[model samples]
Target: MGNWDHLVGASWRGECWAGARAELPLLLGVLPFGLVYGVLGLQAGLPGWAVVLMSSIVFGGSSQVVFAQLWGAGVPAPVIVGTVGVVNLRHALYSASVAQLLAELPLRWKLLLAYLLTDEAYMAAVGRLTSGPRSAVRHWFLFGTGFTLWAGWQLSTLGGVLLGATIPAGWALDFSIALTFIALLVPSLRRRSECVAAAVAGAVALLAQGVPYKLWILLAALAGMLAGMLAQALQRGKSHE
Candidate 1:
């Protein structure tokens, strides 16, 4: 019995390590973005500790940037909270999608995974979950991936904060955030429905750019989701016929 238990533990650790290794490539894109956020947060007049604390607590890159930008610009606190809430609405969808796989997990485990769920982590985890045979200990895999990303984000943010003091304003590091998002987005347009959705979202965002409180982003996201769902339904109908 002892030997059997030891083997099981070893297998679990191996899976965790495999997950961490698999997530390393995604970190390449994430690291620079973290650095950019740290620098931007500092440049926006956020204290170094506050910037780092937000990265630790918030952990959402785009939303954090928006928060720092808006807060720096003297936006009211309630509006800042609302904007962050709207921006992170997609996490609800993410939670729903993965809820079944994680259903049996303890509440503590569920909470930890939920907190660690980010775009990069979700992309990596879902691909693993769907494309292969399910493992009994797959949650550990998620923990491994999430924890790896969490560490990377913290370290890179620290690096950025340290360097932010000396970095020149002329370097234009902020544009890199958009480019990073584009890189992440382009690869996910694998299906016709997804492509249409992305196109619609882009159009709506562009047309609604002047909307106050960054509401255009929320509108664009909703429009894209609806477009994608409609396209998928049409495809399903055609397939059944």
Candidate 2:
């Protein structure tokens, strides 16, 4: 019916805007962090174009920071690359979650969606698609959220790179980056097992702080993932008993 079509049409557009709006807060939260990254990247003597390209191409903030830090320290290229890969291994989880909603889409669309996938966008899109038709307006929502974030991140990084030198030393904004990660992790720590996994990870990272070649980050991540998976398995076994 014409009425049904009109209703679907309206909902699709509205859903996109709604999804974009939902991500607005996160966008604001990430802006300063991105700016900090840009500023630090330049201060560390990374090329301006390299900073922009890293953010534009890789589009992962944490990984970019690690790479810049290691590169500045004169670490080998392979070590820097490996460190970034380890830092971003968490994106695998996001890809798996988003892939479920996109299975029926064309391969081209799936590829584009995969490229757009990020921490905040994936989280928002997954929550929005709980009951909706997968094909209805999910991709639109994803596009709106992902596009907004992509724009914000690019602009913020550029701003930081251009103004890196003038930013005062007393701002103490670097700490905010760690605060942002804490905000992200706090909400994901609902279950006891998740909390334990996080605690174990924090302890390992601290203990391994003196390790060479930044192997501690990789070790900490693998140990945490294993501990969390084991906790879930044990919990499930107990429940089925």
Candidate 3:
């Protein structure tokens, strides 16, 4: 029993390390975005404490940026909630995609992971979780990824808060958000259906740019999924012919 316990501990540590290592590269994209948000939160009149605290509580960078922006704009509480909620709908999809991988975890583990699940963490560790045969320590992999991202975000945001108004407008750190997402997205377009989905989503996003409250994101995601499904169906039909 002692040997067995020791082995399990070692396995857990190894998986955690691997997960964190995989996530390190993506931080290049996430750090700049966090810095931009840090600056934005201050510019939007959020106190330094509030800006850092939101990172802990909200834990969603994009939504946090939207919240700060809307709050600065004097948008009503209800409107802000609606907009933030809308923006975070994509997280539900992320949860669903990884649900099976985590289904067997305990409720406590599930709750912790659900809180930690962010786009970067998910993108960093998911392929590993999904690729091989299920391992006992797989949840640890996600835990490693999520915790590392959480730390990085906090540190980056703190750096931003410290920088405050000093950051140059010419730096354009917010572009990191687009670049990071594009990097995550490009590798995932493995199938023709996925390509179709991305193309349709991109078109819809461009066309809907002026839509209020960033509804274009939701619209683009839905359009992309639909287009992908249609493309997949047509491909299947052709194959059957």
Candidate 4:
């Protein structure tokens, strides 16, 4: 029994490590973004404690940015909430996709993962699962990897808030964050439908850019989702004909 227990513990540890390794690239890419968010949050006049708490509680970079911008600009609270809520609408699709795979998991595990399910982690895990036979352990592996990225984001954000003033304005770490987002987005430009959807979203955002308090981001996301779903349906129809 002692030997069996040791073996089980070792296996669990290995699984966690594998998951963490799979998620490391995303965490690397996310570090700069988190730092940028912290600096921008401070620059936008959000309190330091609010920055840290937002990272821990909200844990959504884009939404956090939107919230900070709205707060600084004195936008109404309802508008801010509505805007952030729209930007986070993608989480629904992610939750549905991952939910099918995690159906056997406990309610608590599902709820926890749903909270932590960012775009990067969801994309990474979906690719992994699609490229192999299904396994019950994949969820645990994803949890490990996603959790690592989450912690890295929080720590990086905290560091930025602390050292933001020291960093030179000309350094433009924020631009590096934008570049990182582009790099992350490049791989996602896979299918023709997806490409079309992205183009449509960009166009919509540009057209709506003058709208108040960053509502355009939400509009862009909605436009992209609708376009992507339409494109997918058309492709499926063509296949059946």
lDDT of residue 173 for candidate 4: 49
Residue-by-residue lDDT tens digits, candidate 3, 1-241: 0112222344788778877887898888789888878988887789999999999999998889878877876777887887688668778878999998889899999999999999889887777667744578878888999999999999999999999768664454545656656776897688999899899999998999897765676677678879988999999999999
* Residue 54 in model 4: lDDT: 95
Ten-residue segment with the worst summed lDDT in candidate 3? 1-10
> Which residue segments of model 1 deviate by more than 4 Å?
1-10, 169-172
| lDDT (C-alpha, whole model) for all candidates | 0.82, 0.76, 0.82, 0.76
Candidate 4, residues 52-139, lDDT tens digits: the string is 8999898887788778767877888888888888878878878877676788888998888887788877765665444534555657
Clashing pairs in 3: none
- The regions of model 4 sitting more than 4 angstroms off are 1-10, 127-136, 167-178
Q: Is candidate 1 or candidate 2 better by TM-score?
A: 2
User: What are the candidates' C-alpha RMSDs?
Assistant: 4.6, 4.0, 4.9, 5.0
Model 1, span 76-143: residue lDDT tens: 68877877887788788888998988899999999999999988888777765555456678787777
Query: lDDT at 8 for candidate 3?
Result: 38
Q: Any idea what lDDT model 2 has? A: 0.76
TM-score of 1: 0.86
Clashing pairs in 4: none
